[model samples]
Target: MTVSFRDSIALHANALSLREKRNEILASNIANAATPNFQARDFDFEAELARASGPAASQGSGVDATLGYRVPVNRSLDGNTVELSVEQMEFSENTLRYQTSLAFINRRISGLMTAIKGE
Candidate 1:
């Protein structure tokens, strides 16, 4: 039998990439929370992931609708769409998911190593 690291780690690897991107986006939203007219942006993680895993998936998600600005629960006076609390919550969740993806990839690699060792 052949060991395909790429296949085994593909999902987790893609998740890590997306999670990192999400983390950055969330951080940016938080950073610009006080900036007037700054709209908070985020991608549909599940949709993006499905598209990414497709056979002919392109790196550029294009100008598609997957990316969107978050709607605030309460509108601000300065026209800023970034809700600080929401952004913080999203960042924290993304961080946790990123850690989870890392753990899954690590376990997959360990299992592959064990299989390769034939022990």
Candidate 2:
């Protein structure tokens, strides 16, 4: 079976995009932690990722609402919605995931080279 570079790259590209967005959202939440009445928001990451990857996931998902949905977190009496600890935790987790994905792709490339060299 011929594996096209386009298809292979799509997987990594989409993952990278998701990581980038996650970082942005986390940063935004941290930035607004002290803002009164600011409600913490989070995108439907899994849904967005599925949509970007292919139509199969989109159709199987059966509804588009989840893909782009951003919901507000329950608010405190002070109206500050940013939870610093949670944001930091999520950010660290995402960074690890991103690094893992990159490593996997690199290993794939290395395997391809080994095959080409008949080693």
Candidate 3:
């Protein structure tokens, strides 16, 4: 039986990619916090994961149609939607999740190597 690592590790791999993209988006939001009329953008992680593990798997890219603008809780007079507190929180959370996914993939790879070694 042919064992495809892609199939076995798709979830964690895609999740890591998605989390990286999210981190970029959140960082961009923070960078643009002072730019007038700049709308904060983000993507739905669950939806992107679904798409990444679905028909879009062949595309080999993490991005999809899930990106959207964040609604401001308190609209700024400058029309910027990026909230520093919220962006920082999301960035930190995403970083943690990314590290978790990376660790999981590493463990999985190690287990596979052990199995192949028959030790």
Provide backbone clash counts, one per model. 0, 0, 0
Give RMSD (Å) of candidate 2 vs. truth. Answer: 4.8
- Candidate 2 lDDT by residue in tens digits, 43-116: 66677777777756542232232323234355567867777788788888888888987887788788878988
Give the candidate order by descending TM-score: 3, 1, 2
Please, what are the lDDT tens digits per residue for candidate 1 over residues 2-24? 64667778778888888888888
- As for model 1, its CA RMSD to the true structure in angstroms is 2.9
TM-score of each: 0.89, 0.74, 0.91
Clashing pairs in 1: none
Where in model 1 is the C-alpha error above 4 Å?
1-3, 58-66
Compute the lDDT of residue 16 as modeled in candidate 2: 71
- Write one digit per residue (lDDT tens) for candidate 3, span 21-77: 899899999999999999999988988788888874774665554789999899799
Consecutive 10-residue window with the lowest summed lDDT within model 3: 56-65
Q: Which stretches of candidate 2 lie over 4 Å from their true place?
A: 56-74
Name the top lDDT candidate. Answer: 3
Position 95, candidate 1: lDDT: 98
Alpha-carbon lDDT of model 3: 0.89
Please give the lDDT score at residue 34 for candidate 3. Answer: 98
Candidate 3 wrongly placed segments (more than 4 Å): 59-65
